[model samples]
Target: MYLSLLTLNSRSKRALTESSRPYELHRSLLKAFPDAADGGPGRVLFRLDVNEQTGSISTLIQSEKKPLWTRINGYASFVTECKCKEFKPALSLDQIFRFRLRANPTKRMKSTGKREGILNTTEQVEWLRKKGMNNGFEIIDVIALDEGFVKDKLTDTDNTGHNTNMFSVRFDGLLKVTDVDVFYSTLRSGIGSAKGFGFGLLSIAPIKE
Candidate 1:
């Protein structure tokens, strides 16, 4: 797997425009890997982080293939720095790490067969707990930050004229790996839904004691 960090120049008009539109931003990131197709091998996952106070923008991208960010035209001017590195996590059973996941916390309504965002904070935390159980991790301690809704309009070839509102929540905490194999898969495949629109990328670091 490969991980990339792109620090964008928030002051640039093009950067600001794409940042506001998730679909456009996703398209922009895909320029890094011209040969890769969505939902195919080498699937790309990304998360956009914006510092409201500082007006700074940065994005983290994870993929099965290495990305050549320079392939994108004029992308260098929009970014202050771009870094990509190989990511291979050496995890053991019962190993603990600090983790952050920006996910779309939701549940499907049985009657309507449609998914709805979990609005309550407690329920949001429970959502992550359930995910950890199935994903081969145990949540030792965690908190959910309600990031509200991310509105996106699809202008792409297939989904043109479609609009979507995705509720986003940031989960941060310490978790212990219960199954190394399963945990590694979770890290690569990510967690939750709406992955294409900047949700479900899990970032973690070993805890230093």
Candidate 2:
């Protein structure tokens, strides 16, 4: 059983690339406190340097989006920590890391392949790949099920109400899964910014061979 640790700090050259939609910490600051400015402390947008499970600094704007494991909002959109706790899976048979993954075949909207019921995990994977990442990545399986095993309404109510409409995948083979950073960044991100990114981690339950 082997596990590899990976970290990212944004490409310095890539960071300097031009951007029509510039990222301003003020965006978050403004959103956090709309009336704090023009008088008192003005507005205070906190850019926390959260150390993710992978030891990577939260550089992108997406570092702020929380994971769903806490509230079960549906599929985690960003990189996810490999949480092996809730899974009571019996992997003795094939000792496989089974999950679902979709591919976005285009740059437009539905480019992330056709989803079975709803939500598009395809696009999410593509977004991460485009950012130049390769953390034992693979779409081991793809189950277009008409039913899911979870419940409704994420804590934020941001996903397809029915959990049935989701793509599941696993990372079990020769590697001990660590964390997964999934999100949508349209080939554009500022220097040291999350741009359109999201990430998270997961604990692991290695399948016994």
Candidate 3:
């Protein structure tokens, strides 16, 4: 596993567009690994860092071979820096860590059998509660950050050809790793849905002893 951090040029239009749409960014990330196929289950998890001024991307890419930094044309200039390092995962039972994740909280409607996002704060928290239970972790002092709809240049046909609205909620808290295996899988595969659109990337830091 390799973790890469890329600093992007914010002024570039292509950068702005790609930053807004997770689907496009996924494609952009694949360019780093020439051997990776364009379509299939992805081995990469990415999250954007946006502030008042600039934005950056941090990606956890799983590959046996080192990746080559590939830039998109006309979209933006090449990444300012591609910092990469070999990653080795270490875990222990009942370990606590400071965690952060941008997740798309949603559930299926029992009546219409349709998938809808949970935008309500109480419901979103409940959704996370259930998710944590199933994923073998517990949230301690978690707060949710609302990041409204993420509109893309293209509309989703399944969504009545309307702009696919993704309700992004950022979760920050201290968590105890219960089931080591499940926690690892959650970190790799991500939490809820809309992963392609930048929803489910789990970031964590060891608690200072």
Candidate 4:
């Protein structure tokens, strides 16, 4: 696996446009990995982080293959810095870490049998807890920050003519690995839904005692 950090010049118009439209940004990021350009099976997960006070913007990308960021046209002009590093984390049962996940939390509607965004803060936390249960980890403490809704046009699916809205929530907290194998898988595949729109990437760091 490879981890990349791309710092973009907020003053660039292109950066401003893509940042606001996650779908476009996702497409732009895919250019770095040619194998994924044709809608291949390669998985690329990313999370955009913005600092409102300093107006700084950076994106964290995790992918199965190494990315050639220079392939993205005009990257040198709009991107201030691009760094990529191989990632391999050692895991063990009962290991604790601080983690962050930008996920589209949702619940299935009993009547419609369709998934709906979960709005309640309490429910959002519960959603993560439930995910942890099945993903081989246990949430020790966590908080959810509402990130509003992400809007994008559906170009590929059957709902191509319409625009879709996905509620976004940011989760930050501490977790303990209950099952190393399962937790490792979760780290690679991510959590929750709407992954294509910058949701479901789980970032973590070990908590030093």
Candidate 5:
């Protein structure tokens, strides 16, 4: 019943395009654990929390108004896996992330959902290039799913409320992306609002680092 919301910097959504900051950090344990100094690739600690929201990864982004120009359309959502071949401490809740839960207003509560967190994944990835990656670290590897979370979330699970897979890994990664590639619509009709079909990430958990 609780959905946490995180206004992430699209760029940070490395799993979407580049940089696996968290994954790389996790790999640190094996390469630098017990030797994790300030600048060394040692065992580092970090915590990430996602805010509450609604709708499927596909239902979110209503348009591309960020640059207030380009013709960006449709948002994207996908799972990313980092190839940190080596890990000593092993990625756990402590090393991966401790999810913070929050209650985000549903479509019924908010008015502008579509324009809020919906945009093209490719365009998003491209935009991020201009924004520049500056997390104070180097990126190792990345694997992005071509499909959006909304489309991917309900693919395996029954969209029907009776057997909904509300808790699936659409865009799995170490650090979090502010706009985890989702769609929301507040409009009653038109291109933005889903009318009733909307989705968001839930019960997010990190895999073994």
Candidate 6:
């Protein structure tokens, strides 16, 4: 496992295009690991953090072997820096940490027989609550950013010939690791749906003692 951070100028047109079309960005990111280009179980999980004025991309890549090369392009400056390091956390039961996640919270509407995103603030919170339980973590304190969530229309068209809509919510909270193995799996495989569109990358930091 490798953790990587890429800082991009929000004003750059190429950055804007890559941000809008997550599929394109995914392909671009995979360029680093040629072995995974054809697609496999081992892949990269990425999240885009953006504000009204600033943005950055963080990714967790899983590869059995070291990548042939890692590179990034399309930035305001000629050199687009990408920092990477081995990701190996020594986790234990009841270990507390501060966590941040950009997730797509959704539920299938039985009435409509269609998968629908959770939009209400209360529902959004509940969605995360359930996810935490299933993922082997307990949320001690959590808050939703951007007024619960934001909606994004994917720039690339899907099989239906229509843009896919993604509902993204940022979660900030303190969590205690319950099941170490399960938690590790959650960290690798990610949470929820629409992972390709920059959703479901869970990141964490140690809590100060």
lDDT of each: 0.89, 0.26, 0.73, 0.91, 0.24, 0.71
- Per-residue lDDT, model 4, residue 178, is 99
* Tens digit of per-residue lDDT, candidate 1, span 1-209: 99999999987998998788877888888877845345443678899988999999999999888888887768768888999999999999999999999999999999999999999999999899999999999999998898889998887677568789989999999999999999999999999999989999999999998
- Judge candidate 1 against the unseen true structure and give its global Cα lDDT, from 0 to 1: 0.89
Candidate 2, residues 147-171, lDDT tens digits: the string is 2221222223464443221222221
Give the better candidate number (4 or 5) by TM-score.
4
Candidate 6 structure quality by residue, lDDT tens digits, 1-209: 77777665555676677666776676666666644345642657787655655455434444333443334443325225556678888899999999888887888898998888787878888888889899989989999864333334444454444456667778899999999999999988888987777777788899887
All candidates: TM-score? 0.94, 0.20, 0.84, 0.93, 0.20, 0.82
| Candidate 5: 10-residue stretch with minimal lDDT | 181-190
lDDT of 5 at 59: 12
True-structure Cα RMSD, model 2:
17.4
Q: Write the per-residue lDDT of candidate 3 for residues 52-143, one digit (tens) a residue.
A: 55345434444334566764443237466667787666889889989888888988999999888888988888888889889978877688
lDDT of 6 at 20: 66
lDDT of 5 by residue, 64-117 (tens): 111111111121222211112221122221233322211111122165433333
lDDT of 3: 0.73
Those runs of model 4 whose alpha carbons end farther than 4 Å from true positions after fitting are 36-41, 156-161
TM-score of 3: 0.84
After TM-score superposition, the amount by which residue 92's alpha carbon in candidate 6 deviates from its true location, in angstroms, is 0.3
Candidate 1 Cα deviation (angstroms), residue 87: 0.5
lDDT of 1 at 153: 81
Q: Candidate 2 regions off by >4 Å?
A: 1-135, 146-204
lDDT for residue 109 in candidate 3, whole number 0-100: 97
